[model samples]
Target: MNRWVKALRAPFFTASAVPVFLGTAVAYNHTGRISVPDLILTLIGVIALHAGTNLANDYFDHLSGNDDLNPHPTPFSGGSRVIQDGLISPKGVLIYSLSWFTLGCLIGLYLNWRRPGNVILYLGLIGVFSGFFYT
Candidate 1:
């Protein structure tokens, strides 16, 4: 309803929790241990990453002038209102994008250290690049 609430992208945020559920399921299926508590941390971390990325995408798209266009809705745009509806500023989007991407990188670094094979290096690097390259 509101711009701020819309910006959070709650559905996207919830999707982050999918990783925790998936991880726990895999661990249980393989190790026979379903540790809900541990998964809570996983969920939190993942949620952060997802939220960060979503925010980053929103922010970057707005900054790049892509959101300001009046083109037909496509897969990427999905008809976002920031640009078309003039819901927010480009600078505002950049600030939000930088914030979320930074958060994602921070969490990703932590994850890499905590779990070496986290593929965090790959995920983080690509993710950061995507933020810019998705121009």
Candidate 2:
């Protein structure tokens, strides 16, 4: 349970929820009401995307030789435990990350394809860019 929690990077969870809340707020902001279903799906997608990013960051950093650096850095250098501390494996994290990311992307694409305007596309692109730079 603890390991799973760490893989999720609990601290970042709240930020993940923001999109759902924001999307709902947008729904309401213009019409004085929100779409509950949209809110729910947004939350789900957020969870998958954020969790996947966390795992990928862990896996890639490990691959980049930053994970093995002894004594740990000032949090400025790469390599965070999720794996280094034996909490998980690089392969396990990689697999989970890819799976979740794919799920999230599919969901996002589905939702946006139904006429999500530009918000969804912008956010999705931002996420992919973030994942690329995060390592």
Candidate 3:
């Protein structure tokens, strides 16, 4: 469990979660109402996207020898050292990253179904594309 958390870089989820929270707050303020389920789904989707992005980055960094070359790596920089430290295999990282990306897209699809437009679909596609290719 601890290894998974480190591999997922769970601590950095705040960077993705904070925006969802602020967006929900703003929507509630404007509408005077909130859909808790949608909010929850949004949070989950965003976090999954974030986790997928982090894992993808780490895997690509490993492939590029970036993480391997780093002399010192902290929790906040140089990517997670799970692969370098042998805590998680590179293949495991890629599989987990793809799985997270799939989960995020599924949640986004559900959220889009609840909404009136295809906005979420487009956003999700863009996110996945950019994140996967970000390197």
Candidate 4:
């Protein structure tokens, strides 16, 4: 696989998107309506958030010496081995994570502007903070 692809951990994006899909479905089933643009924006924002979280985890784990000591790390236990394996630099990972996070925030701001509500802003802020501090 490509180093960039591995760094993004594309497979894990579904975990973030599933909630958005389920929520949209419930809303549609209840109201018999849906906003396609909103749905698309939500999905994009969520995927970016998830990617940022994963990158942050990889960067922090490497920084804290955890990944270095995990001799028999599994896919779920240890962080992605991209950094430890020299596939990408720690600085690169951090920058990538920050960029995704910024993108997610920008999407959230756009959603708030379109919908006129604080819910999106609050949720996005919480998700960003938690994801960045999870490790």
Tens digits of per-residue lDDT for model 2, 20-61? 787677778889976677677778877888778877878887
TM-score of each: 0.67, 0.79, 0.95, 0.95
Best by lDDT: 3
Q: Mind giving the per-residue lDDT tens digits that candidate 1 earns over 57-114?
A: 6666655566556367553453345544667665665566567666667766766787
lDDT of 2: 0.75
Cand. 2 TM to true fold: 0.79
Q: How accurate is candidate 4 locally (lDDT)?
A: 0.90
The TM-score between candidate 1 and the true structure equals 0.67
Candidate 3 ranges beyond 4 A from true positions: none
Q: What is the C-alpha lDDT of each candidate?
A: 0.62, 0.75, 0.90, 0.90
Off by over 4 Å in 2: 70-80, 116-119
Evaluate residue 18 in candidate 3 and report its C-alpha lDDT on the 0 to 100 scale.
96
Model 4 earns a TM-score of 0.95
